[model samples]
Target: MVVDDHPVVRDGVALLLRGEPSLVVVGAAESGRTALERAPGLRPDLVLLDLRLPDMLAPEVVAGLRTGCPQAKVVVFTAHGDHHGVQAALDAGAHGALLKDAAATDLVAALRRVLRGERVSDPRMVPGTAGNQAALARSGLTRREYEVLRLAAQGRTNPEIAESTGLARNTVKTYLQSALHKLGARNRVEAIGKASEAGLL
Candidate 1:
């Protein structure tokens, strides 16, 4: 099954897989709820799931697929490789996570590996491979702190970050302060620079 909210992406993936002799696109769904509801009946061998859906996040979708179709492997196919939701989905038992920007051959290879029971993550999304998770760990920054720092790096003010994240202004400030201290930076500007250098932003 292929699950993505965008019609073009959903159909495009399905079309691509149909061309591969080793694979079959059994079903396509535009949302997590629809995918879960249809998965049992479809009985697909694997699912290509988007990380963000209008109705649910990646982790929730992965959990539902696990329960509803335990026989099928779940692989997250997303554009937001750096989003914390990707990690959450992987932790929730997704077999693999591949970035949408990957070449078609790479995507097919990764999917084949997952179908053979191997866990795969895009190199850019992997910890030490891209210095993402390693940098995050070395800095001792929590997921929230990393998220806030990322937003700050994007030139968002504290209030804007709070509004975008649905967090209180003070909470955003505290997260930024913690992130700054962990990165050994004196202010947001320095923090952003250090994070960029470490590949954490």
Candidate 2:
């Protein structure tokens, strides 16, 4: 089964898998609700899921799949590897998480590994990577804080960051402040510099 909100992505993945002699694309769903509802009947050995759906997040979907299809393995396929939702989904019992930009061969291999009972994560999404580790481990910045800081690095003001992220101006300010403190920077410029040096930009 493949679950993604985008028609192109969902169909594209299904088509790709169909070309594999050892794999079969049993079903495709455009939302988490649809996937959860159909998973039991489909009885797939593995589910390739996207992190963000219109109705639910990856963690919620992962939990549902775990309960509804305990025999099946769940792997998150997403573009936002840096999103906190990736870790949340893994923590909620996803067998693996792979970035959408991964090569087709790598994606297939990762899925196979998960089906064989191995836990996998994209190297870029791993906590030990410089940028990701700095934000998640060393600095302890949340996804929102990192996002706000990245925007600030791009010279975006608080209002711009808020508008882009759909967060309130004050909320954006708070995130920036939190990021600055975590990075041990006194201001946005210093924060940006430190983050850039740490490969967090």
Candidate 3:
């Protein structure tokens, strides 16, 4: 599946995906709404989602899609460099994410890795990977998801998140869900506090 607002980008990526024998260009759409609408029926093994769809944020899109397609893997493709956005994608339950400008081979490899049941978090462009769980508890969190939680704690809205990130709004929601579940919180506010208590934010 390819969920991007841009036809050229979507088609280009589709062309690339078609080349891999293990991969398939299952579906393509210009918006998250359309992606969600079609994805359930397509039963795609992987979703190559874009960060700039016209409806719903990418994180939210990822979350919704997961509920609709529990077995499908999601891979976020975007040019946004905000580490928090990358984390948010992971938090949203995305199997992987990559900068849109990343090498084509990188995207292919990421897809393969995610489909193989690997968790692929983008390394922070900075010095440390902070999203991993704090050592005090028997907990686990990818470094990227932690970044999403920290930013959500800082009070950024989904669109504000888009401005600050390379991720789409739905992808951010996915991160929120992952964080909330990990913290055993019922909502974002509680998730924030719990993550803070765990030194996750």
Candidate 4:
């Protein structure tokens, strides 16, 4: 299974995986909602997912599938390598993290390892990871930022956050973007996720 919102990259990766003698591209979903709908039917042994999607956080994606298809091992394939990004996937029960820039051979090996019930991590993604707490505190966010972060962590859109918080939609977006930069996160998902690790949310 492959879950990514980018068509070109998703199709390209899928094409490569289809050539593996021991693997099959059982399903492809561009977003979490579709993944939840299709993953149960596909029953894939492993899932290759991106941590950022158009509709939901990747951790949510990982957690959701654990319920719908409890047996599948998930491998995160994403451009992000921030501490928050890596920890979020692991906390969501993912078996591994494969950076998007990793070689195809390495990606295959990670998949095999995860399917074998072992954890696989990209070394560069491991920034002296004593624990998520220390890493998250390094993000330096304020209480209000943490509030906005909690909603984003749950996969709410800027518009959704405005509705929930009574803030202007643009204000929510500004906070999310600012939070991302503050956390050294590449996206809203990673920022909010790191916040969760720090018990900020």
Q: Candidates' TM-scores? A: 0.79, 0.77, 0.63, 0.64
Candidate 4, 1-201: lDDT as tens digits: 899999987788877777798987877999999999999999999889888889988889899999999999998887766435567778889888878999888888888889889988887664324444454456676544655776676677878777655688888788878788887789876766666666655
Task: State the C-alpha lDDT per candidate.
Answer: 0.86, 0.84, 0.74, 0.78
The residue-level lDDT of candidate 3 at 12 comes to: 87
Model 4 regions lying over 4 Å from their true place: 131-201
Q: For residues 24-92, could you state the per-residue lDDT of candidate 3 as single tens digits? A: 787787888888889999999999888657777788989999999888999887766464545566788
Runs with alpha carbons beyond 4 Å of true place in candidate 3 = 124-128, 131-201
Give the TM-score comparing model 3 with the true structure, all chains together. 0.63
* Clash count for each candidate, listed in order shown: 0, 0, 21, 0
Candidate 2 worst ten-residue window by lDDT = 126-135
Candidate 1 deviates by what RMSD? Answer: 3.4
Residue-wise C-alpha lDDT for candidate 1, range 1-201, written one tens digit per residue: 999999999888876777799988989999999999999999999999998899999899999989989998999998866566778888999988998888888888999999899998997663214447777788789978988888888888889888666689999999999989988999999999998888786
Minimum summed lDDT over a 10-residue window in model 4 is located at: 126-135
Tens-digit lDDT string for candidate 2 (129-192)? 5446544666688867887787787788888777666688999989988899888999989998
The reply for model 2, stretches above 4 Å from the true place, is: 126-169, 181-189, 196-201
How does residue 131 of candidate 3 score in lDDT? 41
